[model samples]
Target: MEHPIPSRILVFGGTGYIGKYLVQASVSMAHPTLVYARPSSPLTPPANLKLRDRFRSIGVTIIEGTLEEHEKLVSTMKVVDVVISALPYPKVLDQLKIIDAIVVAGNIKRFVPSDFGCEEDRISALPPFEAVLEKKRKVRRAVEEAGIPFTYISGNCCGAYFVNLLLHPHEKSRDDVVVYGTGEAKAVFNHEEDVAQSTIRAAVDPRARNRLVVCRPLKNAISQLDLLSLWEKKTGRSFEKRFLPDEELVRLSNTLPDPENIPVSILHAIFVRGGTVGFELGKDDIEASEFYPDLKFATVDDILEVFLRPGAPEPYRGNFK
Candidate 1:
């Protein structure tokens, strides 16, 4: 942590589930954090945000604007040193416009793009994946071209992946975990809280000064089927799941080079083939989950039990930005 403390952060998408946590955490770190909550539109409530008493307690400055909402962005960036973006993964390019606005204003010392799902940098023109990676690459290039100090926080799947889709006890589908092959491909999967901590680490430590900084926790990895199995153990239910045959999955995967409607097709693809990248690293200075600090990870069992289980008590409730 070279810098004593970088102050004044502008967090794009601060009303998101993870964004609210980052906002509260940033405020706790005593950084003057401003949230880019859209000004014209009414913000929708982000379920896991508003409930935190600390969230309410934090003296967070809310800036209502988008990247195109230049006037507002400039005004807010005038005082901030770092900008941590938590916008949707697909919108990484649009977020670049925000980065441009920040640099144009002559302030932002560092920028954290909303790239917390798999190492997009490592992905290639594999069927269905080419286009998404292109967008991510474009945004990264924009930062490099602009000479903006940046950190591409790489994480596997979000807590939502386990808690919402595949292994939750209360899945919309009661099917045995749908998997690719035997589902033994391990990859980095960081919890939202850990990712936020990595963001903070990137924010605080000048040493993490790479054009792309990664903060993965120690042994914070799992496989597609094992993850489901972990959930099965926790929920004590054998899932009625089906495994997509490799040939069929690969054939289906062929349609993904440039998905027709990206978001929709991507969903279809994941459900069809089931996906994995098989990467895990030593705690890369991005590990900070006091909620279960002792445990290396939430495990499919631990996270869903808390975040995904129906009627589980949530921490904050900021609306989606």
Candidate 2:
């Protein structure tokens, strides 16, 4: 919890889009870092990847392994002071196995589980998002039961990943900002760098242990209209916003029988519910402005440049849906 972590920091799922950034950030520091991957994950090792690479470069102790192997997880974790898990949401609940192994292996002062989205810690309840929250809760409980020092982190937005997943302009209607229900509901978002920095803070801060940290970029809140305004300003184009009425959206969604297609109504409920204000950044994330005074984050305009503006960026080059 001092100037930096003790050393030998390990990252699970270190080859993901964000995971690569985390490893890049950590390996640049004057401490040892290790990465755990299955050697077959979708993220291929970049060209000329190497342990000597630093922030945005190739640098990390790339250990090929699987989280399913309890013995290997324990063995690798045994040598590290902290663990930053960047695995997918799908593998979150299974992290119980990893936590169990860490507790058994011991000497682990901290663990940063892979929570890189809306602040479940601050959001009083989970609705459509319950399935995602359920996994996070299970992993937290596993860590608590194991008596391991932990930092439960909720970030603004996972930067590129979320934008890529959620925002997709209709191909035919290029000027419309498509959203669920009224676009008035707000949810705060932070860049991947911001999340990574807060994670590093949580990893080393002994005082931050056993805490639920919600973080975001330092700024005033904005609504979907405001977002579209920013897009208009950035792209110099006229755009119309299409709002989906709540009831009709629900009826349309209910027609789909599968849970996979349960409907946008459910997801809309989670977003509009009282608890999830787009402005949410736990006290610490808001306070991070002081520690890293120059920290910069992408804004609505920046997102629009690649997402909406005509000829701003290639169709295939954007990060969002």
Candidate 3:
């Protein structure tokens, strides 16, 4: 049962962190790629303009419009065979409008919504994270009810991004690392590039239609202690370990002062309560690495080696460090 590759692929949020990689993956796979971008606003930053130019130079088709413009979205969608949404957390619920546009367009073969963090259907997160998941779930329900052939990608935590967050790898000056909970609960951390590649692959595969494709590489499935110890070994330096007990995480989640800082609550769910530890390899899960055996995966050790190398670039220094 070979699934035919999509000739024209459309990506929403194609300039985002993961979206940019998806755009490149689609192009590299020789799919005629289209990116849905909003028309440039007066306040649009120069960096964004440069990103658009970069995409254009590589021959990506740009459809400039808003999700509010239903007719425009439908007209644009009508030309593509598959649609992949990489809309970020804040805009996740906006996918329902895109699903509506897909229904109106009536030619979309497969739709991949933005379930790239965790399996939104299963985990019970704290208020902040749960609200984000709930919006995604709403989009899922709408996709199902609209009868859109869909593929839900459960990519777990992205290693390049989340690892920096968890271990503060960019902060070379730091003498201590915060160990969430007992630092014993294991979680999968797929690199962002792998997530994008697997996502684009699933979007075109008939076997992936109406299925949940989870990206859980065995080597990348690690705990905070595993990451901390690995970093220490790589750097040949020992640092103080500060443990954030599960009880403290719960207390902060319940009493955080600012709602925007609610990521504290989400981290509590992931590290303390083991929220993102959804699938075990070869046991009731569709592991992407196993499903596509040819692609090499990045493990936590690999990540630590790169980020801890001499003169390594501080990618997330400003915000994460």
Candidate 4:
């Protein structure tokens, strides 16, 4: 059980929302960090370009290539001790290719596939949510079959983003907060950065080998109504509470005209059915925070502050119907 923390780390989606933080945390922790990025381009947005430059400033080596380059992937893996894939949702299955490369390279001490949401294997969600998790499940099976030592991170919801999605945190002008189901089901909501850091901790910690690290910060677990009340107290305004019961959500999932309205359906699973209800720390799972107690996790109130900031990104206009 005693193993040295990994000194070298490689991140596949390093420029992404969560991966960027992983790269930062790795570098700050004094690990030699590398990030996989596409070849530079004039068409690349300035923000992305700046992020690449920033990673370089903090000594993160950026490897330029695509997943199709199996030889290149193997070559890159040969230099690192850990591989953390933070690939976007649609691209989750592409990690199968990464698994193949890891098997070929054969030196990876820990492989953390991108299951940064709920514990998909344990939770039975609707088709839209299940379909997304099936891709990740494939990657997980591939890694295990390949004899790779792995750690699965089920960090539940990323508080800021999902809270925005669930509660419409950025919609200050809105006179009401929609309450999904009875607004009484509690779920874990770890800050995305905390999720990233805890994942990195698990990747290198020998104790975490072949384990499932659940990020259910006790303080971060609360109901939709708990969040609404917090927001109301923070703003000193009681927004109208509109209730969207479970039956209505299920009906909407079945009847919505646009088959592409899967996002709405996913919301039904998380808010109505309680996507993270299956795993509770001390009752059914191990807590990632127990491994790194010194790390301070942001509270729901802290997350709300960020979303409520002036000129915060516009409220998501997607399928919140």
TM-score, candidate 2, is 0.79
- TM-score ranking of the models: 3, 4, 2, 1
Best by TM-score: 3
Give the poorly placed runs of model 1, Cα more than 4 Å off: 1-6, 40-57, 172-175, 253-301, 307-310, 313-321
Per-residue CA lDDT of model 2 for 1-321, tens digit only, reads 236644678888676655766776676555587888776434655632443244224445767777778898889888889998888766777688788888889889889888765555555432335566667777877788889898877665454443443454324356565655576666555566666766676677676777766654446235555655665675577666667766655665556444443325334543445234534454644344344455555664555455554553222231111
Residue 188 CA error for candidate 3 (Å)?
0.9
Q: Write the per-residue lDDT of candidate 1 for residues 140-228, one digit (tens) a residue.
A: 77888888877776655566544455554454466566665555655445666656755665675576654444534445556676677
- The TM-scores of all predictions, comma-separated, are 0.77, 0.79, 0.91, 0.90
Compared with the true structure, all predictions reach lDDT values of 0.60, 0.62, 0.81, 0.80
RMSD of each: 5.2, 4.7, 3.0, 3.1
Q: Which residue runs of candidate 3 sit more than 4 Å off their true CA positions?
A: 1-6, 278-285, 309-321
Cα misplacement distance, residue 215 of candidate 1 (Å):
4.1
The lDDT, on a scale of 0 to 1, for candidate 3 is 0.81
CA displacement after TM-score superposition, residue 260 of candidate 2 (Å) = 3.3
What is the Cα-based lDDT of residue 237 in candidate 1?
Answer: 66
